[model samples]
Target: MAARERLADDPSITFPGFFDDTAVQTDADGGVVELTGALLRAVEVAADDFLGPQDANTLCVDRHESHRYRVVRRQGIIFIRIDEDPRACGLTVPALHSGAQYAIGSDGRILRRLRDGEPDGSLAPTDAGSGIPVPTSEVGRSFEAPDGAVPLPF
Candidate 1:
């Protein structure tokens, strides 16, 4: 969606002016910024992305030409597990990985690059006091221990 059309979707959402040409930006308080127009189009997307109950496969943000992404939320952090290109998310250099998981402060700044996530979307994320609470999804919540090759408790 065009920026103007996105602006029409939700007029209240304000993207930080820090996004110049690239998405990687540093906030005023020394926080790192990730996920810009390249990853998620804040305007064109609906309010659900911001305030929706994320599931096993949830759309993070649209990038470039409305690329949908599946995300992971753990330890109070959001991780991009998959992209439209089928490349892995949240690992290595952005150029090498095509696109990596995005991190941002609740106040509209980028969170510091902590570490790269695993292939199965295991991010090893930490709790940074961004004030945005990420609840544990039902996807892996049922698994208590492995019953042989089975990954679930049942």
Candidate 2:
């Protein structure tokens, strides 16, 4: 069976086969997808779609100027944290000023969303002073995409 099919059938695996596509090439040594050109653009588009609409009234601030993201697979789930690109914002000190985070299932379904610093109420409280709580399961919360939705490759 294909790797994608095997991943889909294995409930123990949480990382989606989102990057299994013709446009993406995987490195044999580490099995890491080399995202470039069209594939990179597609992933960006997917992230934007997942983020939904933003307020357009800001004067000179471009909310979509750039984004820095971190992806991790742990305990049978994939978590992604996206923050505003500090370098592009020209900040004197490095920091993640604003952004959104979410967890996705192997089926490419978004399980939960944590906007800004607020955690979804269903999440269990972490250790004291650990900041926002981590998601423990699929909460059924999902973003409704428009006509053309791009599949995320991570």
How many residue pairs clash (N, CA or C atoms closer than 3 angstroms) in each of the candidate models, in the order given? 4, 0
Where in model 1 is the C-alpha error above 4 Å? 1-63, 81-96, 113-154
**Local distance difference test values of all predictions, in order:** 0.35, 0.49
Point out where model 2 deviates above 4 Å: 1-46, 49-65, 93-97, 123-154
TM-score of each model, in listed order: 0.23, 0.40
TM-score of 2: 0.40
lDDT of 1 at 124: 44
**lDDT of each residue in 1-154, candidate 2, tens digit only:** 2212222222232332323433322425767565434334333433654444457763222455456556555554565566666567666544444665555554454555555656446545677775776475635656564455766555
> What lDDT does model 1 reach?
0.35
